[model samples]
Target: MTEDLTFNSKMAAVYEKNTRISIPTYNSLFAMIQSYYRVQLGEKAASLLLIGAGGGNELSAWGPSNPGWTFTGVDPSEEMLKIAKHKVVELGLESRVSLIQGTTDDLPKTHLKFDAASCILVLHFIDDVQEKLKLLGSIKDKLKSGAPFILVSAYGNHDESELQARLNVWKSFWIDAGRESSEVDEMVRSAITRLSLLPEKQIEELLAESGFMKITRFYSTGLFAGWICHTE
Candidate 1:
């Protein structure tokens, strides 16, 4: 499977719409994450390190609501980061949001540590298990102790009947959202070629190994699942 999941200019332009269509609960998931963070940090000022922050959806969803929060968003795709930068400017969040066109590994070494972090819809793109762990570990290294972290990813044992059922439901969602059957089929086929799925049990294990604790799954929609945890 190819691990290069970065979007081209054409794909980046329609990312938001396509994401909303493919994941029916996209807004709900963002809302829940924002709510969780608000409840945890309260009125205190906080910094968030957003992994795969390319599309700017997280900033669009969380920035206005949490005036005390600042963001350092990193993504590997230049095209996607362009969209994020555009959103930051359009939302008047330029002062609070920094968009970086690279991975966490590219972030400069510093004493700065974030209050919390999130990796949304990004992990499954990495086909190598160790690379996934490394990314998680890098996020952990940038966070303060006990910092809350959210991980959302597409995961399942493809051989399992339950996963197959969820996949069918997911495909139906795309169809219902106005994607042509052939387009949906092609999308699914493309996703399968790039997606790296793990069972929930394995994901939890990865969290543990990455120095995160108190792992709790907070949301599930179709084939996508989200977990909220804290740094050790």
Candidate 2:
């Protein structure tokens, strides 16, 4: 699992390029998140905490638009943090954004609480489902009552047989780009796999058990995108 973290750090470096190929889907999902935040938090100044904040892309997109907001991005990878720090500087958002290097299991509890938090494409990497729920529970504790926690994860609604077929297509695409078989295997394994997909019901139940109220699924796309939000 530690090696998985290293692989994820490498993956983050290539994320921008990968997302470009899937721009429409990514845009729609981000739009949903933004709209949800605006409606839930209203027009007031707010603070946001981003868990697994690889590359700091989300903050870059959302921060300037909401000038009064402050963002704290936390991730476990030093490589990813380096990229995020550089991005913050490049965007001239140093005053609005802060980067912290740590995992959910080791987050600093002393930091000021946030108005909202997001965990995008992060929970699946945690091998234990219970631990993942516990992480969400901890994040909820770091928020004031009525604060929102938005999450996105792989959905389990896709046909497993078909997804495997499409993954074979992706595998071929990687091979055509000159990656070796072992390299492709490692990448595919570390990327979201079928096994990582969780059902929508399970997600809502976990969030509820973690003390989140008013949990709702907002957007989903063939097991690729699943967005949910709840309040503390």
Candidate 3:
């Protein structure tokens, strides 16, 4: 197996391209996330904490239109962070974006709380449920009361036939996008091996346990799901 999930330099170089290929509605997902924030926060100056900011997609998509928004992004992958930094520079958002090369735990102890946060295309990478809770708890701890938060993740029980059927459709999406069948097969295998897919109900449980409320499933495509909620 190639272990393509690892965000090394090689993978980082092609991350955005591959991601778009894998998720047909990739761009729209970010747009929806921003839309949720816009509806909640309005045109006021607000700070955002982006978990898994290595891809820079959130920074690039949300920065220009919301000039009043400032972002602090944290990711554990150095190579991926390099790509995100380049994107921030390219977008000329140096003043509004801060990229940190570490996890939320590495963030300095501070009393500052953000107005919003996003965890897009993340979470599934952790196979452990406890770790997932920890990440969600950390994000909750960083937000002000009733702050909006968005989470997009791969979900569904891998052992079930319904999810397998969805996986088949997901594979065809890649193949239709021009990826070689064998390559797509391996990618799917890698995903099944590495991703920690849970049933939708379990994901909601995690959100509620982490002090989030009004959890609503706002988006779904193939194996991926998105939810919007507010910190409690």
Q: Local error of candidate 3 at 172, Å?
A: 0.9
Give the local distance difference test score of model 3.
0.88
Off by over 4 Å in 2: 1-13, 157-195
Alpha carbon lDDT at 29, candidate 1 = 93
Give per-model TM-scores: 0.92, 0.78, 0.93
Q: 52-92 in candidate 1: lDDT tens per residue? A: 99988999999988899999999988878877876787689
On residues 20-122, what C-alpha lDDT tens digit does candidate 2 reach at each position? 3433367667777888888888898888889988677787678768887888888998876766766676578899887788865565667777898998877
Candidate 3 per-residue lDDT over residues 1-232, each given as its tens digit: 2343333435555887778877889889988888889989998899999999997888889998899999999999887787787777768999999888888898778739999999987899887999999999999999999999999999999789989898888888889988899998898787565799889999999999999999999999888999999997
Q: Where does candidate 2 have its weakest 10-residue lDDT segment?
A: 16-25
Candidate 2, residue 103: Cα displacement in angstroms equals 2.1
lDDT of 3 at 132: 97
Candidate 3 residue-wise lDDT at 194: 74
Candidate number that wins on TM-score, 2 or 3: 3
Where is model 1 more than 4 Å wrong at Cα? 1-13
